[model samples]
Target chain A: MSYLTLSITLIFVIIPLILSKTFKLGLERDTIIAAVRSIIQLLAVGYVLQFVFNAENAVYIVLMLLLMIGAATQNARKKGASIKGITWKLIVTFLFIEILTQSILLGLDITPPTAQYVIPISGMVIGNSMVLGILFLNRFTAEMETRQNQTELILSLGGTPKQAVHTQLITSIKASTIPTIESQKTIGLVQLPGMMSGQIIAGADPVQAVLFQLLILFLLLTTAVTTSIMLGYLSYPTLFNQRMQFLRESLIRE
Target chain B: MTKAAIEFKDVDYTANGIHILKRITGFFPKGKITTLVGPSGAGKSSLFKLCNGLQTANSGQIYINNKLIEQYAPTVLRRTVGIALQEATMINGSVEKNLALPLTLKGEKLHKELAIELLKVVGLKESYMSRNTQELSGGQRQKLSIARTLVNKPQVLLLDEITSYLTVYPSRTSKN
Candidate 1:
């Protein structure tokens, strides 16, 4: 690796420690712990990828992706304790996003099933899916818990549940996409995103890197919006009953 | 004869197979404060929820404003039957934001003066309009909660142990 790459990695490793001390961010222990865990986890995955990459087995690749989807779904469940059956809902969304993106890349002959392409693309898709899952699940659970009455009250007042929660639904989608929006706005000017910078470091032309970055941004937007709206709508029926009353048991965390 | 503001007929509600409100039947008049007094777990809160359409009866019907409440939309019902529980929370925003939330939810424009006027009605100072609700005193927050309910000018307001959180004097002051 070039000295430049090494230097960038060093900065990523050091910045958190400096931030924790300078600002008394109060997250020093967790930051250190997470950094260590990430290093160990990434290294372990790297070793496993050596075998998977050589085999070039689509089944293995898909199995790995399924494992990731399962983990993401579990995290979502734990995060939103009252959200039952979200695992399958999330898996379906992940599968849809993944297959669609893979087809685009493969159809365009951009990158083959090699580890260099599939792994990174899958990583991006999985990472974004995880974030969207957390945001979508958190928004739904919190809104459902606190606003259940207002929701039912609106229904009683002659508004459908969809109409009653229209604002809330919009708010949830906005909350999920705001980070992506900010990143898109600040891309290039404020900070270098990983994919574009990685392409450049891999000796891709700057213009090519820019095009790839644009594609990634577009994909992220589509996935985030779709996953957020889907999760919100799917989770609604879980919170109410046939008579339209808020299900007390569904709202309670076991 | 005008229909009562609220009528619950033979309401039986069981959550998790445990009866919360059993065979409840009552009529609350409009333009008046009808207190539901009972010992703890006497289904007082459940009854309030049923009347507001927050909960449905297992085997009965509710009428609000002379119409079957179930026929009304959720948003409309909520707007008419304003509710404030003991754990009333002020959302993360200015006092004006919290007060104007109901109207805003109904797709109305912000009415800054309405928040201040309602705050004053609940014995809060006019200056509290700009303050963050988190910084308010307990009674101040309670008053603000009541003020929030009034944004829609709800025909019926549901209070669950609202005064229970206030200090000795403000409770008396607010009721009067």
Candidate 2:
């Protein structure tokens, strides 16, 4: 889109601002700030992508991917700040998802090892996996808190840490993945995903875009399950100590 | 007195920065009921947790059957020292499933007859086995919790306000 077209998108922002003012919702400031931040952030990423695409160095590609993973980890860690070392756990989860998804993509020759393909695809993979990680952590911690007594009872009844948390882990894993699973069940009928829409808008064949979107949906399903189980195993141990005692302090929300 | 089933050696427990049990040193004797009498918030529950390796002591050691509490695998230790909480939180299922949890964790078969016998021990009728736990009354739920704990055959059962839910003393109703 041209700068003129982008500038016209400001009118969309005005709708929220006008609504905030009309209803005295007091969200005008936040709306303005959010719009400005999105503009600056996207512009910054756009320039960086241009540079990376021009360079096409393997080192630069790896570095850019690391940067994305780091940012996503930091963002997702907020949801699980109650757990110690959660940021590192998220880093490992995102890194694993990125490596797994990209390796499969490049290994199978499904997508070319080009900056244009690799970077955007990695971004989507890392982004969705980060969200899945957050959902898993959130549900896991909440389950641990609400079911603290149950967990302890299990422990009291000769259960190992794995047994105590077995139910919660399964519940959280299912909870985190349900959204992705349900959304994919009605992907085309309910919403044409952004990737497909973007590809079609850029003049790609609709059928090809649909095929690519399907690939992404499958990758997302893998990510949703893998990230949840990995994060679940990694973080559950943190809820207890070496003595196999449930650390009640970890359940207290800060 | 017979050897203590569980011993607390200068145990100190803190929760939320408040000292709950300060330098507690005591023992609950084997094959005997040991009552820990205290007003509400008096660390009675905290003391029970320390015994079962559910909560680690802040600055002391606990022993179960003459072994350091930490030395035993928590899974093994918990099998010997069971605790039933005040709320008697039931799993989302029939009474049979809830009773089978401890055995399921141990990879043992769910003994239906044993569950019925334990139900009778906890003043619960055998018919309650197929009933959903959610449908039970508060007192019945507490009895179910006690029966579930007994399924594991814990050597030292820690009851936390368990009798508060029952109309009569649990001893009068319990056949065990």
Indicate which candidate wins on TM-score: 2
Off by over 4 Å in 1: A1-82, A106-109, A112-233, A241-245, A251-254, B1-3, B168-176
What does DockQ come to for candidate 2? 0.78
Give per-model CA RMSD.
Answer: 7.5, 1.9
- The alpha-carbon lDDT assigned to residue A103 of candidate 1 equals 85
lDDT of 2 by residue, B143-176 (tens): 8888888887888888889888787766856536
Candidate 2 local accuracy as lDDT?
A: 0.87
Residue B116 displacement (Å), model 2 = 1.6
lDDT of 1 by residue, B44-87 (tens): 87787777677777898888987887887756777788777556
Task: Give the 10-residue window scoring lowest on summed lDDT in candidate 1 chain B.
Answer: B167-176
Best DockQ among the predictions, by candidate number: 2
